[model samples]
Target: MNQQSTLSSSDMPGFQLKALLLLGLGHLVTDLSQGGLPVLLPFIRESFGLTYAAAGAVLMTSNLTSSIVQPVFGYFSDRWGSSWLMPVGILTASLGFSSLGYAPGFWALLLAVFVSGLGVASFHPEGFKAARFFTGKRRATGISIFAVGGNVGIALGPLLAVAGYGWMGLKGTLVFLVPGLLVGIMLIISLGWLSEPQRAALAGISDGSRQGPRPLGKRWLPLLLLILAVTVRSLIHMGIVAFVPFYFVDVLKAGAGTAAKMVTVFLMCGAAGTLIGAPIADRLGHKRFFVGSMVFLLPVLWAFLAAQGMAAFVLLGLAGAVLVSSFSVTIVMAQHVLPDRLGMASGLMVGFAIGTGGIAATVLGSVADVWGVLRVLQITAALPVLGLILALAIPYPYKEAGQSEA
Candidate 1:
């Protein structure tokens, strides 16, 4: 075997960097496809006259599919290589997303979402795994970069879709497909020259959880704890992201545009968290970064509720950054558990985290329906403190009983 082919991520060549950039771009477009859809759900329901539960089902399908399928993909991508599968998923997502512009009726619309859901769901295992492959030194930096790209995508989804709708109405929105196409082309063009990372990449460890780390043991304690903490994290994250605009409009008596800007401010803050928090985690250790993010957020969330005018928006932005960095920190932790299973670790972090959030959204939505959005957020604000405890309790793999194996 050629010795140069054995380069570790720390020694990854410039070609690898280019490849990773491509992966980041591809995953970004893919995520945009998924995250962008929910913003359009109300529009779909209103246009078609669907029930809330039915509309929720349409919105939820991609997440459920994404949550369930990534592990299978992760298990395989570890063995098979992540590069090829991602491109195929990108193409599928592009086609599926494109169909939404012309979807005929209830059945066809659901069909479009379901089809795109699979495509969107399929990308994560491979993308995350590949990011792990590309980054060295605990993979936090790589995961952070990859995560930020996805966050940008998720954060951008609604904004871009709404803009697309404004310019071309339904037809203009299809322009969103252009990003997917560019990414897919870049990936397909890049594949043949780049051989797979050695089996060593997949040889390090495994996690029992579909959402947990990929260390070599059955112990899933830390990962499970983090997942729960993250569920708490998401409940607050999504509630604010999804409902705040409406809250701004209906509850605060603001215009739709001002409400939209408020949501944008929150998401931009989250993007900053993704980009900045990774390096912070790298320097601070996962526990401090994860737990501290939760603690810091409690007050900001309170301020968010009490705030008025621009003050409320600013508080939302600040709280959002602190709260959501947990998403990035958890990604780094996933890599730690699945030393060998970068793709699986990534799938767990990317796919499962978001999927878990979907379930949380349902519960939060019901809470909002019953208790009202303000109270739902107010109750959610403090839940992350429990996340703080769980993150503090996270049993590191080296701390676990099967310690030496990883």
Candidate 2:
């Protein structure tokens, strides 16, 4: 291990703003492809004559490859430094998703989505680990900045997809290739700077010199609880993103463009919520902020389901904001619980938990096929209550003196 690359408690910088923002930009580009997929479902379904279940299976494929398998990648990143994965992952994701425009059949579409998802999965764990090093002392806030990039990308995805479709039909997806290449090249140029300390930190953790004091109880127990909480949250998130456009078009008689805009509104509000909520979480306690966000989500989501006209959009925005506010908090808590396995900690929180919820999307799609979209929305509304209970069950991990609650 390079001596200068190693991160010790004494030498870590307070914050590396430029590098952090660059990572945020990379995150934005990577997730932008993912965001575009949900909005394109209606088009894909119309073109392919897919049923709701099949449409959802497409999402499941993306989620499963991009998310559920993240831990495996994280494990490798932990064991052997893999900063190069960042830029390579970005380019691969871009190429894979952009191929959607030219896919000739349903199987081809799945293959394209799978390729793109692999790129997504490859980026997150390493991206998050690097963000941790760049964040220095303000871990929660820095992570929020990184996470908000993805939220914004998701929010913008609909508009980009809509524009692409309007201009050049399905082929417009090729526009995604531009940002991905640009950012990938930028990250490639900065590889040496980002890799050194990040690799050293991984090395330090592997050798046990950098591990922090263990939390009071069995770490796995709270981690399991936290994963459960995030899983429920992911279920609600995937359900809304996957189904809301359909609900607007079929139930409310809204135009497809309007439906896409609504999804954008939901996600943009989520990005804003992340920005506003993270600092407060640092002050209020991660567990309290997390549990409270779920409490806020339940009523707001229920009201959105019952609402009509403009009120529905307002409530939907609130629901998105409240639900997403806890995202960075949960990741921070997971890292605190498993100090020795930072990469795996990030993967479980951002990957496995979210992917599990995405798997529920397929189930919800099956329900929609039988019961209808309204029923699916109702089921989604009820999920936050379960998440809240799980949040309450998670024991606050023991903090060192002067450390805030995990």
Candidate 3:
């Protein structure tokens, strides 16, 4: 590595709050479309008279397109700069999802969803990579802020969709078009400034002077284990989000309103956890915090499933926080392990791994059909054990000087 190419501590910029917040805003808008899709399923089903399986395929189409194609976009971003993708992606996603209400046929609906999914896929890799550069020394903290924006967007998506439907029937989805356009244009104007850190970081990576030696022994092994851990976490996350309302309404016999509120509370708590956990992880070590959160989650989730009333609510909130606290930690760890492939690492962590877990959660629908929602909840509760083991096995180089600082 050339001395000039190396980025010393002083050479690297400190946390750029404005840039991170802008990236976070982009994240929120991108995921809002994703979050809104599931809530619209029932209405779509009602309108089209489709079977449950067919309606599910709508979400599956979106998830598959958005998640699977992310790495390809990340590759492009790595090979060539991608600041423009952020604005283009936001507009495309907004346009596709907004048109959902007007699709004349089932296939048209899928096409719109697919387009929106592509937009979602395009935004994440570069968004995450830029978030990393903007945060500088506070990678975990900055990433958590960015991750929390997605969490809040997902939590709010259903609310916004429902409101739109209530106000103007299905066409209410058009309301999303406003934010997409506004934010997309804002990002475009900000591009020149935003690309500065990214150009520097890319230069460092390309020059082979970013950090210490890459991990040894099957370079992919560490990343594979990390992905497995993220997948398990996503499985539990998506499963709980998908099934918990049913569990509350059917088994616990809560009111529909209460059930809805529980989901919101759970998601909000997770967002809170993301903010609270990252700074601590920065000090305690990202891997250590990640593993500890997983270990703690198993018991908390089980108790939440078993308890009732106030106790159950407390446990549920705690479980959400503990489970989600590690979300940004895993992304940071992935980028650390694959420093040269930062964009791909971001895509795998935020896209493929999480999306795979969501797709796998659909299997729980089968479990709910054959056994019951309670059985599904039990299975969901047990998933963290696998995540814990994978976290333990990640082969994270805690002793490396570069890693230690990260």
Q: What is the C-alpha lDDT of each candidate?
A: 0.68, 0.86, 0.80
Best by lDDT: 2
Task: Give the candidates in order of TM-score, highest first.
Answer: 2, 3, 1
lDDT of 3 by residue, 1-406 (tens): 3111223444347788888888888888877877677666657877988754565567678878888788888877766767799999999999999998888899999999999999999998988877777777888998999899888877677677777888888889998898899999999999998888767765766677565334454658888999888989988987777677667766778764566566667777888899999999999988899999988998998888778788877888888899899889999888777665777788999889988887865577667767887998899899888888899998875334443445
**TM-score comparison, 1 vs 3, better candidate:** 3
Residue 132 of model 1 has an lDDT of 61
lDDT digits (tens) for residues 24-81 of candidate 2 = 8999999987889999998999999999999999999999999999998887776666
Q: Which pairs clash in the backbone of model 1?
A: 129-343, 206-214, 206-215, 206-216, 207-214, 214-338, 215-337
Best by TM-score: 2
Candidate 2 residue pairs in clash (backbone atoms < 3 Å): none
* Model 3, residue pairs in steric clash: none
Runs of candidate 2 exceeding 4 Å displacement? 1-8, 200-217, 399-406
TM value for model 3: 0.89
Candidate 1 residue runs with Cα over 4 Å from true position: 1-17, 170-172, 193-218, 397-406
**Runs off by more than 4 Å, candidate 3:** 1-11, 50-52, 201-217, 248-259, 307-312, 398-405
Per-model TM values vs. the true structure: 0.86, 0.94, 0.89
